[model samples]
Structures are given as C-alpha cells and as structure tokens.
Target: MKIPSEMSERIKELAEAISEAERVRVITHIDADGLSSAGIICSILHKEEKQFSVKAIKQLDKDNISELFSNMRSDLLILTDLGSGQADKLPKNKGVCIIDHHQPVSSEILQLNPHFFGIDGSREVSSSGLCYLVAREMGYRDLSPLAIVGAVGDNQDSRGELLGLNKEILKEAEKEGLVIVEKDIRIFGRQTRPLFKALEYTTNPYLPGISGSERGAIEFLEEIGVPLKRGDKWVRLVDLTEEEKKKVLTGLVMRIVKTGGSVESAKVLVGEVYTFPAEKGMLRDAKEYSTLLNACGRRGFPGVGIAVAMGDRNENLRKAESILDEYRREVSEAIELLQKEGLKEKGILKYFLAGDRIRDTVIGTVTSMLMGRREEVLVGMANSENGKVKVSARTTRELTNKGVNLGIALRRAAESVGGDGGGHSVAAGAKIPRGREMDLIEFLEKEIERQVNEIDG
Candidate 1:
C-alpha cells in the first residue's frame, strides 16, 4: 500500500511520539472500535517491550479524566477512539496522544485524526484503521484482522463498502490472508446460526413481517419451502443449496416490497460481504465479530472484548458469547418497545425517551437502529449510573446531506449543561446531568433547527 505523502508525514510524527514514551496509560471507549484500538496498541507495546495499562470507558467525565492524569504511575497518556472532540477537557500537563477520527474539537495536542486531512471519519475510516496505520508504520502488519473487526464494529462499512483508508486496510488484510472480500448476501449469521433464526434477527435491511418475530420468520421460511432442518440437523445459510437460497431470498424480497418497503431498500439486499476463513467462532464473520466485541463493551466487560481481540479463545471467548446473547435480548426488547411507543416529534427531529428502562451504553446502538424508519433524526435517552442522563443522537444520510451535523449540535448542547459530547456528524452522543435532560432536548432541537433553517434560508 502506497502511503499518501500527508499520511506518511503524520505517521512519522506519531511513531516519534511512541518511541519517546516508556510507560503508557491507554484510555479508550468501551465499544468495538475502542476495544480494537486498545488491542492493537497493546500488541504493539508488548512486542516493543514497553510498559502500559488500559482502561475502557463509556464516556469521559471529570472524575474519569482526573483519575487518568492525577495518577503519576504512567508518563504517556493515550486516548483511543475518544478525546478528539473533548480535547479541551484533556489535561495539557500530561503527554497526551489522541488516536481518533471523530470531528475534532480544536486543540494543540498531538493527535492522529483523518478528519484533519478532509477524510470522512464516520464512513471512510474508523479509529481502529487509524491505529492500524501507526502499527503498519511500526512494522506490525499482522494486526490487520483486528482493524477489520474494529471498522465493522463502528459500522464504517455499513453501506456495503469500506471507503478511504478502511479500504486500504482491507487490501493489506487480504494480502496477509486475514480477510476475504466477496459479493454475497449482507444478512448476518450466514455461517453460524440456522437460516430461519438468521432471517428473524436481521435488522440491517430490516425485513418486514419476518424480522424480530421468530414465528413469523419460521412460517415465512416454511411457506416458501426453505427447509429449516434436514432430518435432525438444522440448516444454516451456508448449508443451503443455491436453488433453496434463491427461493427463500425471492420470497423475502417480495414480502418486504408487498409491505410497502422501497425498491431501493430491496436493491441493497446483496453487497460486499467480508469473511475470515481461519477465524473460529462468530469472529469468522466481520459483522458478528463486531457484535461479539460490542456484547463485552456494553455489558461493562470491556476487558473481555480486549481479551477476545487479543486472541484469547478459552473462558473469555465463552463468556463473551454468553454476553452477546444477553445484549441481543435487551436490544430486541428495547427496539420493540420503541416501535410500539413511537418517538416524540420536536422540530426536525423525532426522539424516544427510554429514561431508566434502557442501559446507557446501548442507547447509541438503539438510536442508530431506529434511524431511517420514519424519522429524520433519532434520539435515545437513558439513565446513567450517576444522577445524569445518557443521550444518543443519530441522523439519516438524507438529512446529513441536507446540512445537519449532530456532532456540533450535541457537543454545544451538552457543554451548555455542564456535560460533554461530540462525535461524527451522523452519529453522536452526550452525558448530561439528571435534571438537564429536557435542556439537552431543547438545545438539540434548536441546534438542528438552526442547521436546517440555515440551509433553507
């Protein structure tokens, strides 16, 4: 892979920083991207024989930042998948290195972000990819698979293609025989679970009348003559004959269109699918690998995600799989409730207030899932561990193109209420005090209105 001149210069600077640091403290987000970032950095440090410790957090607060800097135990303070936008909050006295791709809040700190070079952080590349660049420069090309997992985890390949630096990382991964890119059905569970269950749980294209309903999916499969089982063994998607798959896919598309779904949505049924032939368990599929890591992150066991990312396949893998099941159940139930209750209309946004019912860590995932279904923007609110509220905001691609930036809006809003927030323009989140939930909504509503009105006016 030919490194662009600008990127090569930046990588050299980052390498210099890494070379200077002896003992390091890595603080990362408790999501798949963050987990992948931590794993990659840890591997690099371990190989280089450097001392380091890691902490995966959901959000950075005063207490968290204080703990990070106040401890004189480590010299280098590294924030991965975070601190790009919260630059002002990061302690200047400490040697801070931010490896992130979010829309950055201006600062003078040493940071490696794609957004600075006119790259789309949300879709083009993820924090894991940026981390991979530094690793590649350091001569650790074997971690490309973990970078792929991180990109998939952040939905950087959500539109059926990996863009910009993500595509480059995939190419390197292919060269290393770490990943195989193929054109196939984009649905989940193609290799692991049974076909009916796969169809039932898929929420990406979101097949109507089948998804989220076990009996509906089963009945539809039977009605279409797609056999669920052969004798005693259940049939998975990988096990299906070409003819059987054709019949099932045709029936599903027809049903979805009959339910008034768009033809464009149906057209997106098949796209580039990523596979890992040598990987065991759910990690074989990039999307499932992401879900497994997410299960650990959102369930307050980011150590498990890092452990799995670092190739621990013993009890840690077993526990991560169990956590994935629990995470799925919670998300399924929460989405169902949101669908039934519907979102509250406010200005150009549609918001759902989950309050204390949903977990704070999973609110962003839920909000993103709710996007593009009768809403210009989706806001998910949950009660935080402290007396604060967690806020997750998501905007449609249509709205994003229409000049909406939730990152700036949420960051400004959260800061106004003595909180902090910022991320990609499309998907961003914040943590605000308990009584400031309504303030956040009002501020966000006004900010979104300001953007839309600026374009319209």
Candidate 2:
C-alpha cells in the first residue's frame, strides 16, 4: 500500500485537521456512497472519542448552503461525496475538508479529490474509496469493507471490476479476511430471492424481454434446463451448480441476441461478484446493499440509509426495507410509463419527457435502466418542485468507447442556457430552465457529435 506522494500530503493535512478539531460535522450526499462515507467517518470519530454529527442531503441548494453556513456551530466541517463540483457556491470557512471524487471547483478550503491526483473519479474511485484511503492512512484498517461497499454503491464496479485505487481497497479487504470475490452471475437477487424472480427484477444491463416479466424469466430458466427446484425446494441463484450456472449464462446471452438486444449487453451477463463472509442478511451482499441504499436515497429516507450503513438494524432497517419495496414499485411503474410513452427520436438522440409525473431523482435510474444501444444518447426529464427541469442523460458503456462524455457534454450544454450540470462520462445530469429543453438537447447533440469526431479523427 504505497501512497502516491501528492495524495499522501493531502491525507496528512486532513488527518491533522481532525486531530485538532474539538467538534466536527459531516455532510454527505444521500446516495449509497455518501451514506457509506459518512458511516465510515462516523465510526472513525466514535472510536477516537471525537464529537461529530452526520447529515445527508439530496443536493446542496442555495438556501440549504446558506443555512448551514449561518448555523455553523461546529469547529470543523467535512463534506463528502459532494461539494467538489460547485466549489464556488460553498462558504468560505476555515477548517473545512471536502473529500469528493466528482469534478473539482476552485476554492481556498482544503480539498482531497481523486481528480487532484490524476485519477479517474467515475470508474477508478468514489468519494467513499477516497475517504477510506484517508481513514486507512490514519490507521483505521477495519473500515475497509464499508469503503468497498461504497465503491460498489457508486457503480464503479459496473463493469464487473474495480479499478485504480479501488483495487487497492479490495486488496486490503481481502487481507483482512472480510470479503470473497468470485466470477459469477452479477444479478441483484442472486443470494436473496428465487432465480426467476431475480431475473425478473434485473435492471442494470437490463435484460429486454425477461426483465420485467416473471413468466418470461421462468420460461427462460426452464428452456435452459436449469432446475427450479430440488427435493421440493425452489433454488436461488446461489444454489445453482457450476454446470447449471454456465448453461444459464449461455441461455441469457442467446436470449439477449434473440430479442434484438445489444451483443455487448449480452457480454455483460456474467462477471465478478463480491460476497461478505461475516455480514448476514440481504445487505451482506455488496450489490444488494447498494440497491437498498439507492432505494432509500431516491425515496427521501437518507437518514435511515445512514443508520443502516452505520449498523442500525432495528426499526431503521425494517423501515429501509419497506422504503426499498416502495422504491422498486415506483421505479417499475415509471419504467412502464416510459415504455408506453416511448422515446421521441430527434437526430442522434432519443428522449422521454415525464414532466411532473416522475421525481427528478428517479429519472436517472429509469434512464439508465431503459437505455439501449440503438440511441447514442438517452435523456429523461422531470419537473422538480424547485421550478427548474431536472434532466438525466445516459449512454451505453460500449458507446463511451466512441469518445462521448455525457457528463462533460451535459454540463456545457446546461451552462449555455443558464443552468448547471455535470457527472460521469457515461451517466450525467443537469438542471435547466423550463423553456430551454430543446435548446439544451440540440447543443448536447452537436457537442456529442463533435467530440466523437475529434476522438475518432
């Protein structure tokens, strides 16, 4: 675990600031990575007998930021998972440490971000991974598992692999005997539910015909000769024999191709999956844990998400479970809406405008779930309560190889119309004025076309 010289200096600065502070407050985004980063820091502070409070917000708005700055009662403020993008909007407060992986903004406050070290924040690392590295450098080694879970939460492991600094965190977890990584089917409900039902709910790299239809999933399994039961008991994905597993994957690939789905999507059918040997229950598996956290965040129960991430298993976990159920229900319904309305094609992109029918937070998830290779860019828009239109853009992983950075494109496009935006290369989002929808789209199309040509040229 040799630390890079530049990152080593920043980590040391943050550790020292924590040592000198009497009272600290942790602020993080509401996503799984944010919750995990808060949980990890909370644990570290608790162990060291430091005074701290953790808060998770959906986004940092002007009013909320002002209130936090005005009500500053703590000696130190640590912003995680966010605050890196809109650095200009942040308050000029001393003793502030922002640990984030998103694109950076210029400010005088202490900042430790992956981009600062020439690292790819979107795929190679997450805010939690960065925080975990800081904690590990401070000699808190047991928190490695939570950091790994946080990386998975952020979709850094979407390609069925962890890269760069994330790989280092995985190695630390392995040495501590906390995790076991295997090359297996990377479905959501593999260990927790029946095989058919698992396939029915699969969304990422979403299986076309079999995804939302239980009957279709069941038929696929049966056609593939995978035994649904043995000795009168239904078998889950974890129960399948290696031979049966291979057959199942082969069948899924063929099904993807037969349904006119992308062969690249079919190639994403099987990959590395991580399992926790010590933790129990559904969240014990990394992917399931991430999904539950996502459900909580999208449904406005981020506090409960943090509680569960920090090991609160009483009413909070039950409440989170209920939230997850409801979240899935909403997502399924929203997906149905999009499927029925369908996407409107305009030149190189396709889109669905849900207006006020869908929440802004859920639009991104829905866009990613329904994205296909046929459309170079997929956009989903919903009206938020704040008057601005929230837009989510998604592109296929394979398409990103063609030199498209949706995050970068979306940011520039949104800014041209007096809005704000940014995200990863594959998935990005923006907030824009209500009347500028078409203008933004046209700009995005042109930018994407030019970027691709420049890369290919």
Candidate 3:
C-alpha cells in the first residue's frame, strides 16, 4: 500500500518518535475499533522491537489522564480511537501523537483526525482505518489486515462495502491474500453464534434483536441440519440450507421501522446473517465484536480485549472470554429486572442498577440498546469505580434529524451538575459526581424536551 503524500511528513515524524523514544505508552478507547487500533500499533512496536505498554480506556476523564501521564513516565504517548474529544485534557508535552477518525470537537485537535482532511469517519471508516493510515505512514503495510479486522469489529463493514482508507486497507488485504470477499448466498437467520455465548459476551444482550445477535442467527445450512462449530460452540440456523441458499437471492432481511421491536425484530432489522470461512473452520457469523468490546471497556479490562485481538491463545483468551461472559449475564439480568419492575417511561428510557456490580463500561451498550427500542433517545447510568455516576446516551439518526445532539445535551447537563461529558451526535457519555445522577437526568430531559419542542414548533 502506497502512503498518501499528504500524510507522509506526519508519518515520518511519528516513526522517528517511535524509534527514538526509549519508553512509549499507547492509550486507546476500549471498543473493538480502539482495541484493533491499539493492536495494530502494538504489532508494529513488537515487530520494531520498541518497548511499549498499552492502556484501553472507556472514557477519558481528568483523573485517568493525570494518572496516565504520571504513571507511564514515557518519552512518547500514542493515543488512538479516543483523545479527539479530550484534546484539551491531553498532556501538554509535545511528545504525543494522536490518530483517530471521530468528528473533531475543537480546532486544537482538528489536525489530529483524518476526517477533518475530508476523510469519511462514520461507520464507513473507523479508528482502525485511521490507525492503518498511521501504520502506512510508518511504512508497515503488512499490518493492514489488523485495520480491516478492527473496522469489521466496529461494524464499519455492515454496508457490505468499505470506503475511504477502509477500502484501501481491504484492497491491500486482498492483494496479500489475507481476506477473501465472495458473494454470500446463504440466508442465516437473526442469530449466528452461540446465543448463550453471545449474550455472555455482549454489552447488552437485550438489544440483540436490533443490534444483531449471532447466537440467534438463522441460516440455510443450519435449517438443513448441518452442524457448524463457531469458535467453541455449536450453531445451526434453522431456516437455511444449501437448497435454500440456491433459492434465496439475498440473505434474510430484518427491519425495525420503529423503536421497541421484539428482540427478534431487533436482530433481523439491524444485521445480515452470513457464513464466514477461515483457516480454523467455516461457520455462520454475525457482527458482535462492537458489543463485546464495549462490555470489556465498561468493565475496565480493555487490555484483555486487545490481547484477544492480538490472537492470544490458551489460558489468556479463555480468561478474557470468561470475564466477558460473566459481565454479559449480569447485564442481561439487570435488563430483565428493569423490564419486570415496569419503570415509567420518561422522555428517555432509563434504568438504574445499584451496587458495585454495575460498571461504567456497560452503560454505553445498555443505553444504546435501550434507545434502539424507543423513538426517543435512551440514557443509562451506573456507578463507577471512583464513586461517580457514569451516564451513557444513544440516539438514532432519526432523532438527530430533529436537531437532537445527545452529546451536546448530555455534556452540558453533566457539567451543570459538576461533572464532565461529551461524545458524537448519536452517542455520547459523561461522568458526574456521585449523588448527582438524578439531577443530570432531569437536566437532560428538559434539554431534550426543549430541542424536540423547538423542532416541532
């Protein structure tokens, strides 16, 4: 892959920094994209024999930033997936290099994100794509597959095509013969992986209907009694077979026209079921890595996820998988509890789970899943390790059409209550001083109502 001329200078500078620095620290978001970005960097550093440590953060707060700079004591810091929004809080030292694709919030960090340079930063291109660009800039073309996997894990491949640097990376992967893109014929129903395993691994299993759960994925082969082994589990899609694959022109289609569809509806509406074959085996598949990584981020062990992505085998992968499954079960149980309690629907769908079991990591997935079920935006709040109330918000593009920017609203609301928050238009998050959770929620409700009324009026 040829490096873009525009980014050549920046990439050269970054490579020099990596080469010259004795100790380096890499921090990234904890989601699949972030983990993948970190993995790519890690792989490069590993190949170059550069000493480095990686940290996966859920949200970049003041304390974490301070601690990172204070504890790492490194000559260089490379931040990925995150740090675009918290540019102001970034270390003042000149040794930091940020590679990201999220929408830039301020002019100070605008130069750091490639999207500001006319690159697409939506699902079409992700942080991994940005990381790939950085790697290409550094002259490591072999690591492009890491970027592709990260993009896929981030759901950037959902459109069935790649755009921007994502496409460039895919082409590179194809040239390397690392990825094979063939037209898929079989119609796998909603679930694709082991339902129990996916639930255990997902941040919000309840929204699998909308977000697409591999566990319940239906497939033509499974429908015909062909047993498929995916990972360590057995899966069969009851509605698909080789004959059905020949008959069906496309994969199964699920639609969620409105919010609050059945879990089944959610599954069908959001994702396409297909079969994926790798050297390990051929099996039914779905996109669940986003939710899985979100769960890991919310739980404060994003490094484990990065390790898993790096192809960690044996005990480490199993341990990470166990932790993920346990977290998923807890979140599922919490959602069930919320439904059973029948909490009144405010302007936003919300549920509060008390006790230390609830982590800041799961809030984004839980809230996003809840919002996916309703027309209005959804917000989920939980207690964090620092005794602060962590809040997560998710809004659809439809809501954004009404001029609803949950990121701005939530950030202002959180700040008003003596907390800090910010995020994208569709999804955002914040951390508030403990005991101000309700106040923050009330403020968000008022702001959302005002925005809706203004648009309607």
TM-score of every candidate relative to the true structure: 0.94, 0.94, 0.77
Per-residue alpha-carbon lDDT of candidate 1 for residues 252-352, written as tens digits (9 for 90 to 100): 77886786555545655676778888887678998888888987999999999998888888989999999987887787777778777977988777787
Q: What lDDT does candidate 2 reach at residue 3?
A: 64
Score each candidate by Cα lDDT.
0.83, 0.83, 0.62
Stretches of candidate 1 off by over 4 Å are 205-213, 250-269, 373-375
- Estimate the lDDT of model 2: 0.83
Cα TM-score of candidate 2: 0.94
Model 3 weakest 10-residue run by lDDT: 275-284
Root-mean-square deviation (CA) per prediction: 2.1, 2.1, 5.4
> How do the residues 192-212 of candidate 3 rate in per-residue lDDT, one tens digit apiece?
543333323333224333223
| Count of backbone clashes, every candidate in sequence | 0, 0, 26
